[model samples]
Target: MGEQHGCQTCHGDTDAHVADPTMKNVLVYQAKGGSAVDELSAKCLACHDSDTHMAMWKMSKHSRNDISCFNCHTMHATRGAVDQPTKCFTCHRDIKVAVNKQSHHPIIENKIKCSDCHNTHGTATQHMIKDDTVNQLCYQCHAEKRGPFVWEHSPVEENCLICHSPHGSRHAKLLVEKVPNVCQDCHDWSRHPGTPYDANAGFTGSSPSNRFFARSCLNCHGAIHGSANFENHGLRQ
Candidate 1:
């Protein structure tokens, strides 16, 4: 049967298994005590090396970590392509939690797949991202943010991770921290650093000058990402 299907090409020397009909005689790619990861991966690469996506597998982080094809892929499985995330979530438990967060990409909704951002097989970019840079990868979907505005937020242009969390966050808009706190990371807050301005502060109308009244810094700096209008240098418009 191995020869009929050319399984031996990958399983290797299944002649002993054909003679003995036992697991011990067969080369199980993912068996706990069987061949080393390199030996197992070599079998997979032999057939997959020609694939454009898999071309970089040899240089991927997964390859360097001794992860084999069997680690993520299950041969002869009847599972659909959408089911792939379930296998990934098994190891990426942290990302599982992040995707479940209230504010997150539409991963759980199945509107998007992990492969949208990542080239799991391999990539020259860090984190196996499909694009050369994170911002470029994001621009694939958010073309609006791919702007050459007159006023630019330096960090927004440099790296999205500076203010936002790629996976998920408790804060709205996937912000790494809450509004004022996120802004305070770069802006100096010596004037009203730790002042507690809640609904009471606005209800009383006593501290209208406080920066923490409503949306905080965003109240004035509305165009936080960038602005097309030249007059909006403070990002207010």
Candidate 2:
């Protein structure tokens, strides 16, 4: 780890630069259309290839896209700059907006980081998520939703993305769609569920309040996720 294997290891043989003080003699990591991305990345992987977090770097989207470590990291910077999310937000502007939505994970608050759910170096899972499955990643924080209920909701069991948007959504509870509408996607729209409810239907209280007037389907079917009640198969409990 002396000068022979230190900065010169990546900077290339710099004896000529030290002797003559010429920029052309030293190897620069920047993308100047001179060196291929692989050539530049190889210098970084020389040391990082053995690190546990970097084991899957070759399979990562960044690597596939020709993004070198130098793109996001500055060798001269202090430790604080190396781990900050600000550099990430420069390229992931959309995620920055999504994280600021009314309902979102605590990324801005620093309680949760992008790395908490994602392996930037790469993973077998799509989106580079840390867990094998999306639901498994979510289960880390929402343990209550990881239940084996007596009567399980098909969407909840299959995938959380079926009803919720993982990033952010304007709808309440990060729902992909509004309450009754979201429920109606799979429910048979034959009777009460399909009926349109307007103020005119119950303005004078002559008719029972429509689904839209109250808390929608959830008013009665409180246990939408699942129901443990022995007699309440409809999730009324």
TM per candidate: 0.83, 0.82
Clash count, one per candidate: 0, 0
The residue ranges of model 1 lying beyond 4 angstroms of the native Cα positions read 1-4, 20-25, 31-33, 79-82, 190-209, 212-215
**Backbone clashes in model 1, listed as residue pairs:** none
Per-residue lDDT of candidate 2, residues 1-237 (tens digit): 333466687787788778887556456877783667887788777777665546778888988998888888776677675445677787888988887888877777888788888887788779999998989998999888877777777788888899998877778888988877787777644533434555566544323344433335675677766767745644564
The residue-by-residue lDDT of candidate 1 on 9-110, one tens digit each, is 767778877887765644576648477888787777766666754678879998898888888877667658537668789879999999888789888888
Cand. 2 TM to true fold: 0.82
Name the regions of candidate 2 deviating beyond 4 angstroms: 1-5, 18-25, 188-209, 212-215, 230-236
lDDT scores of the candidates, listed in order: 0.77, 0.74
